[model samples]
Target: MPAPAISFEFFPPQTLAASFRLWDTVQALAPLGPRFVSVTYGAGGTTRDLTREAVATLHKSSGLPVAAHLTCVDATREETLQIARDFAAAGVTDIVALRGDPPKGSSGFVPHPDGFASSVDLIAGLREAGDFNIRVGAYPDTHPEAADSGADVAYLKRKFDAGASEALTQFFFEAETFFRFRDACEKAGIDKPIIPGILPIENWKGAARFARNCGTRIPDWVTDAFEKAERDGREDLLATAICTELCSELIDGGVDALHFYTLNRPELTRDVCHALGVTPKADLKNVA
Candidate 1:
């Protein structure tokens, strides 16, 4: 049988040098033809304009669909919706709505007093405001603040119940974890597609720190794989195998789509897609 389709995520660059890197990555992976590429919003909406610019450029130039990430961290609900309306005006038809983290150095997520309270709220508000293909974030194990895995799945169902069209999960290492999460969602009565988020551990140190803070597990096997690879400076090669194996396992388990966190780098993601037998499609007309 055929494997799942693929999507990718990128962050809007904050510097000219970073912008070049992001465009380079986009160029390299654009050939593989992701179903859609999402650009992330910075903490506290710091990069909102930059994100808008990047998403617009991708939509206009890359011939790939773009989903702009929106969050209710620092903006009010009206403000957030205005951004959504702006995206609609810019010709974007999809969004990844998230309850983003607090401004850097804050202890935890503290919602803006006038903003949507959670991702479910954001999803609902977006649905009410426009006809968008909304995607919400899901935690397979548990959100850092979730009481348990059951609670995590329950919350995800709530977001879906609020009219989210799809879910892109937090990056996870264990295929069993995702399978179990999928099962839990099924039992909870959610039938929407839950795309597994895949992050190739190219920077082991940085990924470890972020994963620890975000409550994503770094299994012993994963660590050992990277540690062994570190000794030889072959992270790219090992990343290819690890991500390929993980994706293959998911495909075998019945998933139909993947979302890649590209970190503004593309070779690893491109290689992974190539390994999975997915190829980029040719340019299509802009939505506008």
Candidate 2:
């Protein structure tokens, strides 16, 4: 099979030490020649400014296209559109539009009085604001808030109809999970590229918690394997093998692109990409 095209996702740093980690992450993965890299916003859009700064800086200095995460959470419509305009002015035209999570201690998402109320609305506004290549989230398992998996698929179709050009699924534990979701999406008449998101398990505990929060189903076998691996001090080795295997399966199943949620750490992601035959190319020397 031909090597799959890839991208990486990083979140904006919250501290000086985190800044170092983010840069080191870039240095390690940029050489892999990702088609684009995205920076995420913190919950409730708390890291809006930081995301903007990181996106612009990376676009200018890294020789890689950057996608900024734009959320409709706490900001007004005018404020959010202005941010989109600012990103376009900074040479960024790709956006991952989302209806972000509620702030800590909040019950659920509550849009500001003057804000776009949903991700569909956010995508429409971003479309009006600029010529952006918009991306949106998809749920392989039913979204925590959805009535069922079918509802999630229908809502994803609405997001595309609203203006998004692509959908990136939430990370799941099994390749079958993504394949079923892909088939469902096709049946629902959504034809956009649905990139599978891969999260290399660096900390099994943390990943399990994340899966719960995001409504991703984790197989019992995976939990058992991680438990055994942890007991044997083989966490990293097991992680690399599982992630590389998952990518290989996806490629074999006809997926042409993959997105890695690096969580601001790159070693496992780098190794997984290398195992997939995405060898470092000389073009990255310019970015270095």
Candidate 3:
């Protein structure tokens, strides 16, 4: 099978050391010729300016399409739309609109009094701001804030109806998990592309914590395999093998594209992509 089209998501760096890591990550993965790369907003939109700076820098320096994450967090509606306009002025035309997480140390997400309420509203506002290729988040597993997976699919369809052209799902362990979600979305009449998110299991403990927080179901076999790999001092080997297997299964199941949540660490993701026949080419031409 041909290598699937891929994209990567990176968060804005808050510290100087992290800045180096982000740059290193970009250097490592840029040669793979992704469809696009995205910069994420920090919690509560605290890194709004940083995300913008990173997005602009990546677009200018790497000559790659950069998608800026716009969220309805603490900013007002007008302020949010203005950011979208600024992105357009800067030549970044791809957007990932979301209802951002609430500020740290606060309760669950509480939209600003004057801000758009949900991701659906954010998508609609972005559509009005300019002619952007909009993408929204999806959850194959139940979102922590959602009632169930059915609700997640329904909301993702609503996001598409509101102007999102595609949806990138949260990372899932098993291929069947994503296939089930895709089937549900199709049955619900969603016609947009639904790209599966791939998270390479770099640190099992950390990934498990993140999965729990996001309501991503973890199978017992995965936990056992990681435990054994750690004990045998072969975690890296195990991680690369597992992620490549997962990606292969996805392609077999009719998935045409993958979106990686790189978490500012590129080694595992880079290695997995390479092992799955996504190796870099010396020629700087796009290939899917």
Candidate 4:
């Protein structure tokens, strides 16, 4: 199979040390020639300025396409659109529009009085405000807030109708989960590109917690294997193997593109990409 097109996601750094780590991650993985690299906003839009700064810096310094994450969490409609306009002014036009999580202590997402009500609304606003390649979130395991899997697909179709160019799914354990979701989307009359999100398990405990919180079902075998690997001090080896196998399966299953949630760590993601025959291009390594 041909090497699949790939993208990487990173969170904006809140501290100086974290900034260095983010740069190091970019340097390590940029040579792999990802189609674009996205920087994420913190929950409740807490890292709005940081995300904008990181996105602009990466776009200017790395010579790579940078997609900024914009969310309707704590900002007003005008506030949000101005950010998109600023991104356009900086020559960054790709966006991952989301109805972000509530604040750390909040019960659930409660839209700001003057803000877009949901991701679909945010998408429409972005479409009206600028010329952007908009990407929206999708749920393969059924969103925690969704009534059902079918509801998730229906909601995604609305997002596309609102002007999103693509959908990037929440990370899931099995490739079959994505295939099933894709089939459902097709049946729902949604023909947009849906890219599976890959998470290289960097920490079992953290990943398990994240999966549970996001409504992603974890197979017992995954738990058992990680337990054994942790006991044998081979967690990294097992992580690389598992992620590589998953990517290989997806590629063999005819997936032509992938978006990896790198979580600001590059080793496992880079290893998995290399295992999938995505080698570094000599000319693309200047992303300092």
Q: State each model's CA lDDT, in order.
A: 0.90, 0.94, 0.92, 0.95
Q: How many steric clashes between backbone atoms does each model show? A: 2, 0, 0, 0
lDDT of 4 at 97: 96
Candidate 2's displacement at residue 112, Å, is: 0.7
Mind sharing the TM-score for model 2? 0.98
Model 1 lDDT, residue 55, Cα: 93
User: Mind giving the per-residue lDDT tens digits that candidate 1 earns over 1-288?
Assistant: 585788999999999999999999999988777789999999888899999999999899988899999999888999999999999999998999999888998888888889999999999999999999999999986788999999998898899899998999999998998999999999999999999999987798898898987899889988898998999999888889989999999999988899999999888888888889887665566435
Candidate no. 1 TM-score: 0.95
Name the regions of candidate 1 deviating beyond 4 angstroms: 282-288
Give the better candidate number (1 or 4) by TM-score. 4
| Residue 86's lDDT in candidate 2 | 95
Point out the higher-scoring one by lDDT: 2 or 3: 2
Ranked by lDDT, top first: 4, 2, 3, 1
Worst 10 residues of 1 by lDDT: 279-288
lDDT of 2 at 284: 44
Model 4: weakest 10-residue lDDT segment is 279-288
Model 3: which residue pairs collide? Answer: none
Q: What are the root-mean-square deviations of the candidates from the true structure over C-alphas?
A: 2.7, 1.6, 2.3, 1.9
Q: TM-score for model 3?
A: 0.97
Poorly placed runs, candidate 4 (over 4 Å): 284-288
